[model samples]
Structure formats: structure tokens, C-alpha cells
Target: MAHETDPVGDLTEAQAREELARLADLLDAANIAYHRDDAPKISDAEYDRLKRRNAEIEARFPALKRADSPSDTVGAAPAEGFAKVRHEIRMLSLSNVFEEEELVSFDQSVRRYLGLGADDPLAYTAEPKIDGLSLSLRYEKGALVQAATRGDGAVGENVTANARMIDDVPQRLNGAPEVIEVRGEVYMSHADFADLNARQTARGGKSFANPRNAAAGSLRQLDPEITRARPLRFFAYSWGALSEPLAETQSGAIKRLEALGFQTNPLTALCNGPDEMLAHYRRIEEQRATLGYDIDGVVYKVDDLEYQRRLGFRSTTPRWATAHKFPAELAWTRLEAIDIQVGRTGALSPVARLSPVTVGGVVVSNATLHNEDYIAGRDATGAPIRGGKDIRVGDWVQVYRAGDVIPKVADVDLDKRLEGAEPFDFPKTCPECGSDAIREAGDAVRRCSGGLVCPAQAVEKLKHFVSRAAFDIEGLGAKQVEQFYSDGWIKEPADIFTLAQRYGAGMQQLKNREGWGEKSAQKLFDAIDERRVIALERVIFSLGIRHVGEGVARLLARAYGSWDAFVAAVDAARDQGGEAWDGLIGIDGIGTVVATSLVSSFAQEAERASIDRLVRHLDIQEAERPRTEGSPVAGKTIVFTGTLERMTRAEAKAWAERLGAKVSGSVSARTDLLVAGPGAGSKESKARDLGVEILDEDGWFDLIEGA
Candidate 1:
């Protein structure tokens, strides 16, 4: 939790494991609250710190990384109220750099990846990283067709009506491509936010926490009239999918967007190098307070669009851009007590309950302790942090809000420690079920062995099942899930589909229950029935298996294509020493750890039965395949060998993907085409021996020239 001292390098395997687990939970919760609920539990600064720590630890101990690691995740799945919109081009997030060294490293990493020398003139466009909801506006034939919120990168919430109400958003574009997705930030200005809050107060409604939240809430309103009444603005900074290239350079693209009636940020500037970028960042920081709109950092993107395509993406973030975040704001508060809360995964997370204090205009009374070691004043490697002073109850402590979002304890004031303050003794038994909470070897956090028997874990699993990324039953929310679970109406995900059948019109009808009526109960049943036929990925994610997240679920869904295929593969892989196991681990993102988790879930008799029952109630749809109609390479598995002259390997892969061809690293009998370049050797020979279609660089270009 203490990132001030660069403690990641010194963390032992167990410590790293524990911290990663904690981070995964924290980040997952934060992403859901912020992205789906529009109510953030932690500050952006705290989230970034935890995310950075998770990345560092994973980099150090890759084997211990969870399959649902935050590094591979984006925003949470879209909320229930809005229609889902799948982005043609994924809305990836930019990596971050907090210090000058990190910024330099980012520049050098980009240069090295592009085979550039130290003195190479790699220009970048630096602009303010707007602190607002990310919106993607799709225009077809110069008319704004749809607008969506960035939800989990791949899919988003359709908010076209709400977007049309924003004055800054253009209803139509002139001289734009046939199909273009203009991506930018939808924000509320300081004055607009103040006025909106005032209006809300006048109407006896709940006021917003910040302008970002206000803008996000307003833009996501179900009623377009409400959105129209709200003063929301947009700033076009980038483009997603395009029929044709917008510009050769990033700066030129911004200008083009501005000329096309989009409100492009006026402060955007081009920088020659890291030094110039830093200078521009400093200038922006100096004007941050008076800017009227919120900005968390300065975004620096490689100006050359070709270079950007060459660099491409790394999982959830881009390789060519980064956000240099502002420093955290600090305040002092009294540490009231430490409390341990159990999670769905059985990890006992310690949270610091604090006296109410406002760090960055938000009153925060709690902060995550990370792990027991964090409270014990020692890092993973036994290195002392916070001057080796342990945080105790009845002590004054320094708290900071990074990104002005969540408060986190940074330093303990030993001089202010009370005489009777004692070291916290972590519980060895599950507080909810009294089961043995044991820490496994090489594991940092103590997990409850109670499993599903624990009430806390059971309730949380049910909550997760209906979460935005899962079944997302419209009428069923957290409170409803909790009440129904407590009432024994639903115990597992399968139970959710069976809810209407079990209580719709029986003596134990939900309509007869308190706080529920005939219409409401029927609505809930309708929502449940509406989701009876769900996507394969959602079905997999709804199981709530450890280490399995939305991204991993998508990967598994894409690999197997259907629920039956996925189940068959999981059952075959349960033995863990056969071709099934190998295939499971061979998926691009799935590692041995994830594969084992998938298999183990099915191996359990009870869990497997639950999943089986759930599937029986679901008409699981196959994963959607990429549309490659009208392309010559559609449905073909192609391998690119050696060096590509016209484009980088990444560019070739992306191009091939766009053409509906599956790109493979190695040549096999199934290989439909092999594009070989100058340095091709073993793969070329294999392709020839395997009788695969082999094409030279020129031949490859000729074959797909127009298509």
C-alpha cells in the first residue's frame, strides 16, 4: 500500500502474492463502483498506486499473477440501464507515468520498440488528460449515428440520446470519413457543476461528489430531457474506428477534428522530446486550478500515426501513449480502528476506519490497509516504511488522495500515538463462519477454508453473479440479491434463472413479500427471462470462479466458441496432463495458473453441478466472431514469418485481423497462408513441408491489394 519507497522490488513471493490478491479485489471493486455505478469508492490516485504496485509485483513474480489481474482489465462492464454497444475498435486506456524518470523510460521504451536511436526525432502530442467520462461518437455519412460510454474497452453503454443533448457534441460532421468514431471526454465545467449541484439541492436531490461524477451521471441519464437540461461538454482528442485515416500525425488529427465541428482541446501542443513534454506538463499544471474543467494529468501520445500502429496495444493499454499523473493531495486524520472484511474469494482484507476528514473535497473515513504486514510497519522484504512506525488505533496519521478520489493512509504519527495503542493481531479464523483462515505457502493473504459455507462469501458470490459483467438481471441489484440470498430464494447463479419459476405465482410468491408488488415482481421475472439466453462469455463469468474475469472469460469464450465446447474442454483438462490441458494453457492469455483454476472449478463436484444446472437454464450463444466478409483473407489462418518490409509485425498482425484472417505465430498444417519475408527460415521450411500456401512480401501485398 505504501508506494513511496519503491517496495515492490523487495517483496517476497508470499508478500507479492498477498498484495496482488488484495489489489485485484480492490481494483475490481473500484472499477465496478466507478465505471458501472458512477460512484467511486477510492480516489483515482489511490487506484493508480495500487494498480502500479500490482503491475510491479506481477512483473517481478509473473507466475503468482492472477488470471483476473487488473493489468489485463479495463473499465467494468456497462451498467444495466443502457443498451450495450460493442466498439469496432477497442477503447484502450493509456499507461501512466508519475515522475520524470518514468516519462523518460516511456519515451525510450517506445523508441527501442520502433528500433530508433537515442537522438531519433520521435515527436509526441501532449494534451491535458481530462477527468471525465470517456465517450465515443460514431458518425456514418456525416451524421452522428451513435454515442457510447467506454465500458470494459470492448463494449460500452449506448448513450446516443444523452450525447445529442450536449452542446459541445456536434450533431453532424462535414468532410468526415464514411465511418468514423470520434473519441473524447464528456465533462462538466466548474461553473456548470456548481450550478447543477445548486439545482439538485433546490430540487431536494442528492448532490454530486465532483464534476466528473456529475458529468457522467448527467450524460448517462435515461431521459434525454434530463441530459438536455444538464450543461455537459465534450472535447474530441482522438479517433477510434475510421473508414480512412484521419491524419498522418496526432496533432493534425486534432486539428481535423476541430475543423469538423468538434471541440478539440485548445491546450494541446506538440513536443519534440521528453524534456519538452515535461515543460508542457509543468505549464498545464500551473494552469490546472484555473482551467474550469477537471484534468488529472497530461497525456503524451506518439504524434506519428504510423509509429502508433507499429507500436499497437499491450492488452488493456497502448504502447505509444501514457498519462503523467499529478501528485497526490495530503491531509492528517485520526486512525479510529482496523477492521477485516471477507470477500467473495475468501481473502480477509483489512480496512482502516478513520475519523472523517476531507483530503480533496471528499469526506473519507476509511482506507485500505492492503495486508497485515502493511499495518505491522514492514514491507515484503522486511524493509521498514513510514520510519518503521506501525500504524495503531488512536494514532494520528497522514492520509493522501491521489487523483482526488480515495483517501489512503501514508504515514503514522508515532508522537501522537496513544499510550494504550497496541499492535493489531490479525484473526486466524474466519469472522463470518469461524472456519480456519489459513495462509498457504508462498501466499501472502490468509484465506477462509469455509468456501461457500461462509455466509459472507455466499452472499458476495450471488452479488457478483448479477453484476454488470455477469448476468446483469435488470431488476436485481445488490440489495435484492442480498435479501433473496438471505431468504433462501437463490443460492447460486442457476437459482437466479429459476427465481420466477420458484416464486412467481406460488404460495411463496414474491409479490406477496414486503417491499415488492405484483408489477415489480413481474418486472424482475421479465428481466430474468430476458437474460435466459445469454452470451457464452457472460455465462462463464457468471460462475465467479477465482482468477476468471471478463477478459479471461472472453478469451475462453472465443477459444471454445460455445458453452458446450468450453465445458468439454474444461472436463478434459481436469486431468491436467493431456492435450486438453496443453490446449487450455496454449490460449494467448491463459497461463498454467489460469488453466488450473478453470479445470479445478469443474473438478469440484458441487461447483460443477451448480454450473451444469446454470447452463441447463441458459441458451448460451457462441462468441461473436470478427466480421471479415468481402475480404480475400476471410476465415483464413495466416502466419507472418521474418521481417515485413512495408509494415511492422504488429501492423501486419492488426491488418490481417482486420481482414478477418486468424494470425498465428507458428506455421501448421491448418495454416491457410504463410507470408514469408527476407529472414524467414524454419517457419518457411515448415510451411513448405506442410504444403501451406507460401507468399513473398510482394506476393502477399499483391494478393490482398484492394481487399
Candidate 2:
């Protein structure tokens, strides 16, 4: 392979070797930042361009391929934290095909490697490539015993507890081998990601830039209980360390896993040639948004298992498979202005308002500028970076869209800047509250000193507490939350719980007041009443404390078990900052920042009083501890449809699940039980037809109550 216009062709052998070494070190750092830290220092296009340059150099001088060259590495080495699990078989990565010609080359290379004639038949299964965290689950005697991440190809971090929390992951396989490892990607749905971010934003928490990062962050949570609270799902695509062969074909193996109670991608299809494979890829790309989950590309693997064995493997990727990724849409646009938006936690975020331009069919008008250092072209260490140039208004900036959701500034053209353009000066005071904005040490954000005093921060905190993710009332929304705040109907979170008690009986004053109606007011009170009882994690997160997002709140709730225990622990750690403080900070996923925030919030007399008032009006339930082992109905999918004679539908569902069975709403092929009552309908009929066991109300009581 050669390029007629390759830049590296001009360099001498010695110069080429030095440049290759430099590129090798640069790419290694990028891989670590991307794969381990869950943060990418550069755009995907920039990374690919650099890697391509290195490959060109390596091709020109094959003898000088460095021993530590990134070409031989699939991903960075595992970062320190969890225990490392060595893979029994290497979990190799897939070679990527960014363009149609490269995809054609991949097919040709595979055919050439196999010594196949031009007319020979070649079949492959093209699967939608999920943009998520790769996970490997090992099952022994049909029971999931351990799970690990795709850390480096040879070794991974143990994440069995976190993996078990995924609803799609089967806790135990009933119909198969004694030992097997199922390989899959754990991802979050677009809807779930939006909900989580909305809650985070409402509570003044940091929102995820994209769903891929959200899924990765959720899975890598320090506490498994936190992972359980996250809406993460898995889809089995391949396997490792199998005690017995699953199927003779790649597609057949996927079907087998689906039958074994595992979720599999339905877009997977059989392709006879590269044209057919590319057609399927295009079809998937068209339906990407409708699919809900994120997919970066399409993966083509040889259909026949025997052919894969014969084709063998490379050091980092398989010889029989390749991933064809869709190109990111990029366009050059002018930076019109920079705006500073204060978040609920008072962190200042710089947003770049851009001249409208379309990228990948979506019109993008704004992009993130990160922070002050990013705008000034300085790194975390304040060293001049970003090609030794700073971003300013009136400069021509290149932006790219990834998955059509996150649009980022990829590069800047220095020559296209206006003659009199000046750098953006970040504000030193909050725009909404006029408070002192100070940048804390080791932090990228500049925060406002005013806590509850800042209206922007306070309203954001209130919105977060009642946002769809927190106390989520039916009739309440952002508009109503702001309206109520403006009218002084609700001053604090506790005031919401007390609204009906104070206003319900006073129709002349409450319901008949300005902007209030009798029906709407009663509905609001009913909604408030409905939320008086909530789970412990919900209340903890509703407090709107900095760094205590949903995941960390679950970790705290699980550690303390109940609200009383959590409050007591914080109170104990407040004055006596020794073992108690250490214990609070020792919780996984929590650092010094979160611990200090908790203690400080409790120490505030006004904050403590507000919390006490809220606690008095609410009934908070303790979160259940995770039970991954020793449950009779643990992995079984169950459904209870129609009316129940002995108990309500919710009660039956909860009771059945208490014994360890997974309670599903609908009846499917995998359903293990159907509890029916007088009006047993389609679900019961479907269960009977599928041969699923059907138990009546009396029968269910006998089985559950007696046990």
C-alpha cells in the first residue's frame, strides 16, 4: 500500500525513525486517556489522522518499528483500581475501516490471505457495532461467577458485581455448558441517558457529554450498588473460554445466546459480499436514531466458525473480522460569541455560540469551549497547547458531530482569523447572582461562593430536587417549579411536602389565589402527597449536594442502609473528623471533595434545619442490598397480569421478586411464571401457549406464604 502524496516520503530513514518514535509515544498517551480515563484528549479524527501518519512511516521504514509502538497494542494497559483478571483467551480488538475503499481492501486482504479464487463464495455476518464499554462474563455450571472489562487485550479488571446489576445479563444459564464466557457491550439507552443528565442538571450535578461516556462511567462506578441503580443494559455478541462449542456459525451462536435469556442485536444480518455488507451498514446507519442505543459502525465477521479457526489471528485483531465505521461529519464555522452558563453547583461552563452550519445532516449552532484554560490554549499544567494557538471569536473553527448528538470543535484555522479579533475574557462574577467566582485548586471549573444565596444556584437545586429524575411529580414541571418559586408558594424542599397540609384546607387563600385554580391546585397537592414516601437513595439525591449524584447517592445509601444511619454518620463525622470522616470518604466512587461537601452541608445550621423539616414529613424506605448468590428464583423472568384477589398487582410483583425472581411486565418466550387472577387475559393465554407455569392467587399464596 502506498500514497502518491504521502508527506512522510520526503523524510530520510533516520528522520522517519525519530518521527515514528515521537508518534508512538503520542498515540500511546492518547490511547490511555481514551480507554482508561474515559476522557479523550483529542478528537477521533485527529487520533486517526496521527495513527495513519505513523502507519505510513512504518510502511516506508518497516525495519524501524519500535518495540513499544502503538501499532501492536489494541488498547492501553489496565488502570489501577480494581483487581485485574487475566483473560483465558486474548480479547483482541477489531481493525477499523473508515472508508469504503478501506472496507474493500479488508475484504480483498481476507480473500488473499485465504488463497480463495475470484468466484469463491464468501459469507459474513455484519453486526451493528455498539459504542459502549466491552464486558466479559464467565459462567460456571450455568451460573455467572465472574465478569471483567476489556482492559488491555490480555488482562481486564474484575467487575462481576457491577455486571450482575445489568438487567439484561443472565444471572444463571439453564440449558447449556458447564463453563463459558459471554462477551458483550454494556450500554445505556438514549432515553435513559437523557433522563439521567436531566436529573444531574436539575440537582446541579455535571451532565455527561454523551451516552457512551455515561454508560462507561456507570459501569466503572466504584460501588456495585451504584452500578445497579444505573440503567445499563448488555447485548451478547460473542463468547470466550467455552467448555463446549455453541454453534457452527457466528450468527447461530448469537441466536443460541438469545435463546439462553441474553439480549442480542436484531440488526445482525448475513451478507454474501462486500456490496451486501455495505448495504446492511447503510441500512443500519439510517435506522440508528430509531434504535435508541448508540452504534458507531458495523462489524463484519466470517460466518463460518470453521473458517475463522482456519483463518487464525493477528497480534491485536482477528484475521477474519473488520469494523467499518461511518465517517464523522465536519464543517468549518465562525465562532460568533462565548457565553458563560452557571450550573446548579455554580460551576462556570463556557459555551461557544457558532454561526449555524450543518454537519452529518444536523444543524449545529453551539459547541463546548470547556473552561478558561481550554479557551486560552493552556493545558491542566497551564502549558501552551492546542497547536500553540488560542481560540477566539471570529476565528474559523472546524466542528465534527459524533453519533449526531455531541458536536465538538475539532480544529482551528489560524489564517482565517479576523485582523482585530480579541481573546474572550471570562467573567469573574456570577451573571445571575453577582457572587465571587473562584477557581479551586486542582479543579477546572470556577465556582460561585454563594451557596443558597445565589438565585440561579438555588432554583437549579430546587428544580433538580423535583426534576423528573428526583421527586418527579406528575403535574409539576420546570415552568410550574419556577412559577411556584416566584410566588413564594414554596421556599425550600420541605415546603413542597407541607404545601397540601397548609393550603389544602384554605381554598379561599390557596386555591383561589392569583394564578391558582381549584382543580389544578388539588392535583398539585395530590401529586405532592403521592411522593411523600420515597426510597432512601431518592431523598439523598434530592438534597442537591455537590458531587453527590445519583450513583454516589446510591453508594452512600447502600453503605448506611437507612436514612437515620446516613444522617447519623454525617453528624458523627461533622465534629469528630477521624475514623468517621475517613469511613465516609472511604466509600468507593467518593473522594475528598464529596466527603467535605457532605460534612459542610450538615454543619450549616440552616441546611440542617431544612433537612430535619423535610425528614419529618417523608417516609423513606431503605434500599435493598444486592443478592447475586443463593436465590431460588434469582434469574427467572416472571410476570403477573390481570387483577389479583389476595393482593394488589404491585404487591404481587414485589412479593414474587422478594424471593429473587425478576418480575417482568409482559410475557415473553423467556418468562418462567405467570400469576393470574379472575381476569387473566392475553398474558395468561400466552403463558399457557408457551408452556409457562400458571399459578392462581390461592396457588401463589400457598407457594409464597408457606415458603
Candidate 3:
């Protein structure tokens, strides 16, 4: 509630107490929104800001700290459904190393604790720390009996049946201890995650945000069949409740698990000392995107089991282990301009256009300002946040991407701000529709208040309809698309198909238009006509339903197979709250939120009429099941970068997609191949760092032609 001027020292004890109370309530709601709802209302940076405030108040008023103090808390309480199982040995959290110096300090502390001389060498095993759900498997006589989630580090949800469905989780192990508990991570590979989301959308369901969420949602499924349907994998990392010693060292124990038919990370290696540990970390970081799964950090454990025992445990983590994480994917960039975007839901979003900068190997030129409050450096109640610093044009700003795929400005550097920079005054009217932008009660975003009538909403939706991943009309980019809409040549998806009939019949009509000759006009018409026979997935995506993304669209197409089947299913599933609502809410990834959004879209008479009009104008094709059978590029993920010499990059992507390969914009562990061309930048470097197979324009042509 206070500003930067109200310092911690200046806060009266009562004021500090009040602030703590407000923080606790706010944080509790935020945790619920993030953990239970899977719909986070605030950014991670904002949450951190609040948590820091809570801690500051507590520090200033130690005697006034509440029994439910947030400093001691981790995650929220678990949702009901599964039975709870208390952990025999607490599955603790890990201390983190954000910088190289912190890692060095950690190593020094370990050496000091063990009383080992500087010359004396100690080995530590470095393992890629999977970013997924933590699971503990209790085995008796080498037979798995129970599996549980990490709930508050003390108790967890029992999901033994769900665990059994994971092929990576061994049912039985030979020549093992009579009793033992294997603590490991449960994750979904990037490939599996893509497949899962596609499947979810086929059934008219919501798709998971990331592989970690997909894995967690799958493992936590109430129905064992749902879990079985998902591709879940496990990696054995640590242990608890062992009846007999497994090995002398951490790396050896991992090998023992591997021998016992448990999956352990192949990259896990024994390092001689701190320098070796840091080197391994770098090596892993370089290879990170090629691992086929998500790893947030690298974990280093004292290899010697005896030294580990001597170091013992901290209050919440093992003293012998520390996790070295990448610095927050953040960078400083100049804020060049601000743009407003109106979403399908009518929410007006403020976007920041920045001077090109790299954050986590991705070149970002735009970041989200989130809302007016964020722009004003205030909370919802107009309280100061971020040291009460407001952002302006020509200001040096920090941008970061964490859990979100979008970049967000973390803060502004006032010292680097240019003189005469004006404080951004958020507009009160929608830029697209010229309607009043209204902020509703209890909502952060300012909405256009102009529903379907707003041209901005209509035009934005139309733009998304023809986006690269959607219909991808060859000659119809955003600029052309918007131009056509404004000029009344195209108004809807159906209008795009009827463009030639509407204007092409007359030579002077299109050819005589400003900036259009016979050749270019005819090319645009041909491009539009070429896409008349469209895949069902593209059709679904082009509809521009909120929350029903490409993955969800693909899933829907897959489930229904045919356009007719999908239309009928959605038409019949009218009541969002009814059981016939896609019968999809219970499906992994799709859940209630996604299902409701989808059903609501179809429930609108206007939307249904529009879909019908579009359907009648095209030859709709059924979605084929994933073609992994004998396709050479099947299930492979590839990236296209730089300037291609032969065919265009877009053509290369189309070829890859046709061959059943996933065409991604960024290089990650999932990337199997990288097609680099002249002027290739970050993606190429990252691909090389990830050990992804590099292909020239010629090589790509050969790979596709040969396939």
C-alpha cells in the first residue's frame, strides 16, 4: 500500500502489520490462481515483487510476524481427489546458484564443511534438473507399490496406478534393496507434449501450456486411463528409506538404477571439482535444447555418499546439493514505442516495441506492458510497485521471459532515460474501434466495450485467421489483410475465398486499384484460391476462437477427423456446463477452462453462421492421424532461419510439415535439425550449441526430396 518514499524504517509497527496482512491475503489468492486454476492473473516478476514486500515487512517487524508467515511457505495446498501419502523422508527443495560466483561460493562452502584441503579433490555428479512434477516411488522387495507427488514436502497425493502407466517407471527391479524409495522427476518429452496437445484439441479440449504442465496434469489424472493415454517418462535422481546401501557415490547409484531398469539422465557425469562442475554445467547448457525434454537447471551432488551424509540436510534442502540455474532470461533494451492490441475477449493490452535485443537466445523486439497499473508503476489500488518508477519512451528497460512465452518489461532504468521523455498516458478509447476502453470492477485489463461490432476485434481476428500457423494464405500478410478489410474487399474468412468472384472478374477492378497491377492482383487471387482445399486443423485455427490455439485446433481436427463431424459436434455441444460439452473437460490438457471457451464460441449464433459461410466456400479436408509409420521426417522437429537460397523459408516449412515434421520457430532440445541460410543468427548459434543437425539450403532440399 505504501510508495518508495515510505521506507521500511519509516513504517510504524501497525503499518508494517497491516501491510503484512494485505500481502498474505493477496499472495494466497495469487497462489490459488496460479497453482489450482492454472490461470495466473499476474506475472512471476509481480509475484516476486509482492513476496519481497512481505519479507521486508517481516524483517522490519519480526515480533509482529504472523503464524502463517509467507517466508516459510512454498506452494499452495493440493486440490482434493487423490488420497494423501506422508513422505518417509521429506523430498526437500534445493539451494540455487544464479551466477558463477554463487556456484563458486557453494563449492567453497562444501570444501570448508568437509575440512578438505584446497589441494584435495572431491567428485560431484552433475545431472540435468528436470522441470517437471516430483514423484516418489516406494518399492518393497524391488516391486513398486506406491507413488506420490511432492505435497508441501511432508505429504503427497497417491497416484500409483497413474505411475504404473509410465513406461519409464519400472514395475519391478532385480537384485535391489528389500525396501527403498526412489525420488525422481516425471516429465513429458517435447514431442510427446506436442502430440498430447494435438490429441486434446482433436477432442475439443484445452491444451497444456508446457511439457512440465502436461506431465503434471497427466500424472495427476483422476482416471488411470487418462494417464495411460499420455506419454509420461520418469528419471531416477535421488533416494529415501533404503534398507541397504545402494552405492558408494551419486553417479554410481544412478548407474545402479539404470541397471535396475530405471531411466537416469545420460548426461549425468562425475566432475572432479568446482571448475569441472562449472564446465559440466556449461556443456549441459550448450546441449540443453537437444535433450528432447525441459530442464530448468543442473543439479550437482557430492558424489561420495559418505560426504553427503556428513553434509546432511538443511532446514528444507540437502546441504550437499545445489542447483545452478540459468540467469532469468532477461536483458536491457530501449523502449522505442508503445502499441495497443485488443484481444478476442475484448481485453486491451499494451505492448512495448523495443530496439532488437536477445533474451534467452530469442530475439525479442516486443514486450508486454501488461496493464495500465503496470505502466503507472502501481498496483490495482494505485499503490507503488517497482520502486514507483514509471516507464517512458527512450528509456533503458529490462525485459524478461520466465514461465510465459511473451516478454515483459521488468523495470525501467531512470538514469538512462532520455530528457523530454513523456510519461505514457494510456488511451481511454480503443485504437481499432474508437469505442470507450472500460476497466470493469475487479479486473485489471481495460476492455474495448465494443464486442463484435468493433472493427479492431474483427480485423485482429481476421489477421489471426490468415496467420502463418493458421490458414497461411501466401500473399495475404497482416498489412494486405487489414487493407482489404478496410477497403471492404474482404470482411470475413468466407470473404477471403470469394475475393476473385467479388473483384477479380473485372480486370480494371483489381488491376486498376492503387499499388495493384494485373500481375500482383492475379497472384493474390491465385494464392487465396490455392488454399480453398484446406486441412480441418487449419480451418479450426482460422476460426479465431479464444483459448483454442493451434494445438487445441489440431486436437479438435484429429478427434473429429472431418470438418462435418467437428461442426456437428460443436453445434450439438451447446451448453458449456452440460455433460455433452465435448465430453472433453475431463480430458488431459483440455480441462474445463478450455472446453468452456470453445463451447461458448460455438454457442454464439453469429459465430456459427460465419463458420457455415466459410465451410460452404471451401473443400474441407479431414485430418489424418499422425504419420509416423515410414515418413523419414516423421516426429522430427526442425527450425528454419536466415535467408534461404532455393525455395523460400515458408516453402521449406510447408515441406517439413507435409513430411510429418514439426516446424518450430526457435531451437530447443526438441529440434532434430536446423536449416540455416545466409544471415542466420541466434537460432543457428543455439542449434549448434544444442548439437542439432545443421542443414544448408541444398542439404534441406536433399533431405526432403530423398524423404
Best by lDDT: 1
For model 3, residues 1-707, the per-residue Cα lDDT tens digits are 34323678878887788778878888888766654444556654466668767877888889988887766655555669989888898877786777789888998899999999877988899989887788899999889999998766777789999999999998998998999899899988877887888889988899876676688888888999999999999999989889998899888888888888888998999998879989998777655544677776799999999999999986667889998875547656678999988886778899999865545434466899999999989988889989999988888888887654789999887877898999998989988788999987877889896766788888888889899988898878999888898898887788998888878886569888777899998898888888988888888888888778887887677666898787676666666645557466654346666776777777777877887888888998888755555677887888999899888887887667667777888999989999999878778778889999999888887766655
Q: In model 2, how large is the Cα lDDT of residue 704?
A: 62
lDDT of each: 0.86, 0.82, 0.81
Query: TM-scores for all candidates?
Result: 0.49, 0.50, 0.50
* lDDT (Cα, 0-100) at 707 in candidate 2: 34
What lDDT tens digits, residue by residue, belong to model 2 across residues 131-179? 8889999999999999998888899888888998999999999987899
lDDT: worst 10-residue window of model 1:
1-10
Q: Where is the poorest 10-residue window by lDDT in model 3?
A: 355-364
lDDT of 1 by residue, 1-707 (tens): 22224478877787778788888999999999998888998877778878987888899998998999999999999999899999999998889888999999999999999999999899999999898999999999999999999999999999999999999898988999999999999998878887888899988899998888898899989999999999999999999999998889999999999899999888999999999999999888656655777787899999999999999989988999999987747556678899889999889988889765445535456888887778888887779878788888887887777553456788886866899888889999999999999987666688898977898898898889999999898889999999998889888888888787777765347888887888888888889899998898898898788899987887788778888888899898888988988999998679988898888778988778877888888888998654466789987899998888999998888678667677889888889999998878778878889999899889988888887
Candidate 2 backbone overlaps, count: 1
Ranking by lDDT: 1, 2, 3
